[model samples]
Target: MNPTATLVLNNGKSIVIELLPEAAPNTVNSFIFAALNGVYNQHAIERIVSGNWIDMSYSAFHNEKAKYLIPYESQLHPEIEPLPSIAGCVCMGGYDELGLSGCEFFFTLRDCPEHRGVYPVFGRVIEGIDELYRLEKVKTKPITDFPYKNVEINEPIQPEIIRKVEVDLKGFKYDRPIKLPSQVLPKCWAMEYR
Candidate 1:
C-alpha cells in the first residue's frame, strides 16, 4: 500500500498527497508525525507567489519537532527517490540551515526547475491540484500583521486554513526523524543583480 496524507481544508476541500518513503524517509516521517499529531490543523497558507508556488506556515505544534531537520533527499540520492520539483510537487522550504523552523513548505504551482536541488521534494499532490490552484489565486499583499520593514512578504488577505491533516500509511513502516548537525551556520554569498 502507498503512503498518503489527506489535507482537509475548512472550506470542505480535501487535498491528498502521495509521499515517497523510499526516497525521502525522514522527510516523509516528519510530515506523518506532524499530520497525525494535529500540528497542521488550523494552520494558514501564508503565501502564494504568483505562478510559482504556494507557501504554508508551520503549525505551532511543530516547534519542538522542527528542531530535527530533514536532509535534502532528492535526485542526489537517485537510488531512493529522484523526483524533480515539478508542478504539484511538495517541497520543504529553506536551505542549509538545520534547526531553523523547518515548518514552512511550498507546493509548486508550475514546474520549478530552479529549485531542483535546493529543497527536499518529499511528495506530490495526487488529488486536489485544482484546489491548490484556488488557494494559490487567493488575494494577497505585504503582510501587515508582522514587522518586516525591509523585506516584503505577500500574505493572503483571507488565509487558507488546513483544518486537518490525516495520514494513511496502509501498512507502511514509519521511520524516525532524520537527525543532522543542528548548529551549522547559514552560508552567505553575494549575488550581483544584472
Candidate 2:
C-alpha cells in the first residue's frame, strides 16, 4: 500500500497527500520523516501567489537552519519520472545550487508548465483541496524591504498555520536522511528568489 500524509491546518482543515514513492522515493521518505517528527508542526503558511500556488517551510528553514538534508529524489534516477506541477500537486521548494529546502513544500494552484522540473513533484493533495482554496482567500502583502528576484511572495497578513502533520507510512522504511551543518545564505539571497 502507498504511504499517505495528512496535514492538519490550524483552520480545522486537513490536506491529505498521497505520496508517490515510485516517482520520488527519497523525497517521499524525507517528507514522511519530517511530517511524523513534528518538523512541519506549528508553522505559518507564509507565501502565496494568486492562481499559482501556496508555500510553506521556507521561512521556517531560514529560522532554524538545520534539518534532514535529502536529495532531489525525483531526479535521482532517469527512470523515475517526476510528476507534473498540476493543481494540488505537492513539491519540494528551493534552488539547484544552494540545494532544495529540506522540508519546505508547496501545493500548486493550477497547471504550471513553467514549474516543470524546477520543483520536483512527489505527491498530490488527495483531500481538503477546498480547504486549500479557502486558505487562498486570506489577505496577503508582499515584502517591501527584501529584494526578491523571482516569484513575488505575497505573504498572508494573518498567516495560516500547519497545526500538525499525521502520516500513515504503511511500514515504509525511512532511514534518517543525512543532516548537514547550517548554511549561511549569501548576502541578499533567499530561497524565495530562486
TM-score (all chains, Cα) for each model: 0.79, 0.85
- Every model: Cα RMSD to truth: 6.0, 3.4
Candidate 1 has an lDDT of 0.68
- lDDT per residue for candidate 1 within 131-189, as digits (tens), equals 98898778897754343244345778886788888888998668656655656422211
lDDT per residue, candidate 2, 73-174, as tens digits? Answer: 544566766677889899887656555556778999999877776677889989999987987888998875545466587788986888888988787676
Candidate 2 residue pairs that clash: none
Q: How many collisions per candidate?
A: 0, 0
lDDT of 2 at 10: 85
Task: Rate residue 1 of model 2 by lDDT.
Answer: 83
